[model samples]
Target: MGRVGVDGEQRLLLRRAEELVERAERSGRAVSRHFYTPAEQELIAGAFRGRTPLTLEFDGGYEGAERRMLLLYEQGEIRPEPPLTAVAIEFPARAAVPAHRDYLGSLMGLNLKRETIGDILACPQSPGIVFAADAVCGVLYEELREIGRTPVTARPARLEEIVVPEPDGILKRATVASLRLDSVAAEGFGLSRTRMAALIAAGGLQLNFRPCESPSREVGEGDVFSVRGRGRVVLTHVGGNSKKGRTFVELTCFLR
Candidate 1:
């Protein structure tokens, strides 16, 4: 693995990379690792591809989580533990229920970074809110006292223990003159075409959670755009063109 100019964290990642390689070679079995950011995941993947023939596995707690863990395994030789565990928070029904902000605040207030936690499922219909975190889950269950000013109770939970809600976002339909990345993003996000293009050129946005600066890149259905100051727009559908020849697109905008 590349080690030049590596920091402590990068060195740790490389060590884990080495371990994954060593374990596979020693036992002829799959090995797993945790706490990798998306960027880190890619870095490790690139590193592994250069050194071995083993396969890489990636999964966050949920579909759209920004941070996830990586599992390295050999063909037909892997059985890994679920990298994350859920915790349920119970509060008085009448009390004000805190949203992601509060839950996140409470976690970070304890010196936990956002990467240590995963998707937060909070909905009005759900009796309790649940969040995913690393397997070392006792801290959240034991230390979190309240969400903002409202007191609450939290306990360990399985995925089946709670009902997950649709991710937080607003869905809308729009028509764009072209399927070019900039055009669809501008229409879906309610921004002027020039502004969208300008933002992209200025490196102020990301496509599919990865940094992207090209405005003319085509945006198909299910593509996600994360703009720095504005928000995120997910292209949900691409229908046939209108009589005027504009493409009809469905999008879901998730505010940051």
Candidate 2:
């Protein structure tokens, strides 16, 4: 997914979101846009801060989705269905399972914008589900035939057909000197402090869904650290200090 930085493009997206809300208010109808990354969603929400009586809805075709579309409608107006379509891509049982990037790469190869697509549920042994904009479903069904050399079949599916796999997480309880990003992330991800620091410096980590290059940044309970290849870890709890003065922390690691 594309990351929106503090640049012209970010400004344009925020402006567009504001325009959509304003249009909905004036027209007394619903207006929506394509999928947005978590960071972009945060920016939009912040842009509308202090604006009361605004009815905004975010949906990604399912609950707990990371990428979602934004909807703005009048207070008493009936909410319209989100312009979403679920595409199921089935791979041959004998074929190697494709990773998330592979599926995304194939879609991008079809000239689809990243914003038009939402969460991709890569099933281990079943058909993978892709939530996308309704406007792109026809192209996907017609042109999307292979995902990184793996032959596949694409078909439209109901939103309920998506089977979200259970998160595979490893629980850990460890003691760290402090709640710094590097210390807690290293202990949780089983990497050395030096390596973790290097990863953070190289833009390989995200804190709370936004890129964070500061290894010394303090972390708190519920902070999530995502490493590019190592998946993500959540600082679920903070405990009292150990005898050696190290603070105890609990983490749940979900490896990719």
Candidate 3:
């Protein structure tokens, strides 16, 4: 709990862990609820068939610890996820992914790519994935910000940290590291386009946070594209990759 780990002594482990939680609460850092009771300790070792070794999470956000606790339900005690899996990224400036909750849970099932960690997150209701290494994640974050988007967190940002705007708020916008969007919006905003004309005629759509006459407009990073009676969006560059051997752009957008 406090850098000091327990060995074979169960009593010593519980004592130190309780102290750590107390310290965390006082310091305003994330805290861990009560876990690892002395009586339950022996049960865990015995149920796994003669004292199986247990591993604590580097961070207590993962439910791997809880899965172990569930063993307790059958024998020792089944608990919720451990702290290690809770936070996927820890870096302060990184870009997030538009993954679903099941995606995170799938990460637990599948082995992570080297230097990466994956986990599920709820509340904001999305999959949570973060890099384990700071340097790599930091690089990704800087690129996103440079392109005028929010940086993702270091293996600690939860899915709730980012989200897609609701249908009511989806406006055309681009993140950093993305290409031009003038042509893309032209049809949607031009007077000839019946849909665009109707929406614009209603005077409810805004591009780059400005109420433009039409949808055929230039949009880039830091642009707040909005549709009246619809929703707004903030674009975050998510870097580039090859899809079918072709260059592809990725970005995260917040709707509504």
What TM-score would each prediction reach against the true structure?
A: 0.76, 0.82, 0.22
Winner by TM-score: 2
* Best model number under lDDT: 2
lDDT tens digits by residue: candidate 1, 162-185: 676666788888889999988988
Error of 2 at 70 (Å): 1.5
Clash number for model 2? 0
User: TM-score of the candidate numbered 3?
Assistant: 0.22
Write the residue-wise lDDT of candidate 3 on 200-233 in tens digits.
5465666554455654444554544456444444
* Residue 224 in candidate 1, Cα distance off native in Å: 1.2
Q: Candidate 3: lDDT of 59?
A: 29
lDDT of 2 by residue, 16-129 (tens): 887887787788655565899887887777677567366777889888898999887777888867898889998999999988999999999999999999999988865899
- CA lDDT scores, all candidates in order: 0.73, 0.87, 0.36
Residue 35 alpha-carbon offset, candidate 2, angstroms: 1.3
